[model samples]
Target: MNMPPTATDAIKDNLGEAGSHLKQAASAAGEAIKGAGSAAGDELRLGKANLKAELADSALAGIAAAENMGDAAREQMDVLMDKSRDVLDSASELIRERPLTAFGIAFAAGWLIAKVARSSNK
Candidate 1:
């Protein structure tokens, strides 16, 4: 004879199925959380590496700019020094050609400087 399931037995079976589903859902949720945490860590590491690379590139660019400026300044100083030497050479040649005039110019310049100094003190 075939017997039908009782109400209590049916309820117990349904409860068992629901409990199994719940456990599977919880396990899936835990795995999803772990995956999300690992992905976030990977992204953080990648971002940090990118930032460091950018900083290094900027530093290299700054160094190149500074070197260019230094080179330009040195070239300008060299030009100024050459001009000063030329002027000094010309002055020396003029002085040698006209020693008497040079002496008179020196004496007048000294006298003027003394007069200016005395006026300023008063």
Candidate 2:
């Protein structure tokens, strides 16, 4: 037959039960921490991907704007070149129609330039 339980035995049994409950609580807490860390890592990766996508889109938009600006500048240069050609053609036609007048104008311009140069030197 079993002997009645002693005071020491009762205390030992209570301590063992308390230790098991503590272990269970610690395990649960560890699992929760792991899950939280995994979720945080996933969020960080998604954020990085989104940031990269936005940067790419902005870069593409900037490139498109530069191309459009280049095209517009090219068109303006073409117009300016056409106007210059027209002015040159008109001047040539005028000179051909009035050779003596052109020669007299050139002589006057040369004389005026010489006078201006002499005055500047003085």
The Cα local distance difference test for each model comes to 0.98, 0.97
Tens-place lDDT digits, model 1, residues 16-81: 999999999999999999999999999999999999999999999999999899899999999999
**Residue 100 in model 1: lDDT:** 97
Worst 10 residues of 1 by lDDT: 1-10
Give the distance in Å from residue 106's predicted Cα in candidate 1 to where it truly belongs: 20
Structural similarity to truth (TM-score) of each candidate = 0.56, 0.54
Superposed Cα deviation of residue 76, candidate 2 (Å): 7.8
Q: How close is candidate 1 to the true structure, as a TM-score?
A: 0.56
- For each candidate, C-alpha RMSD in Å? 6.0, 6.5
Model 2: ten consecutive residues of lowest lDDT: 86-95
Model 1: CA > 4 A from native: 1-3, 74-122
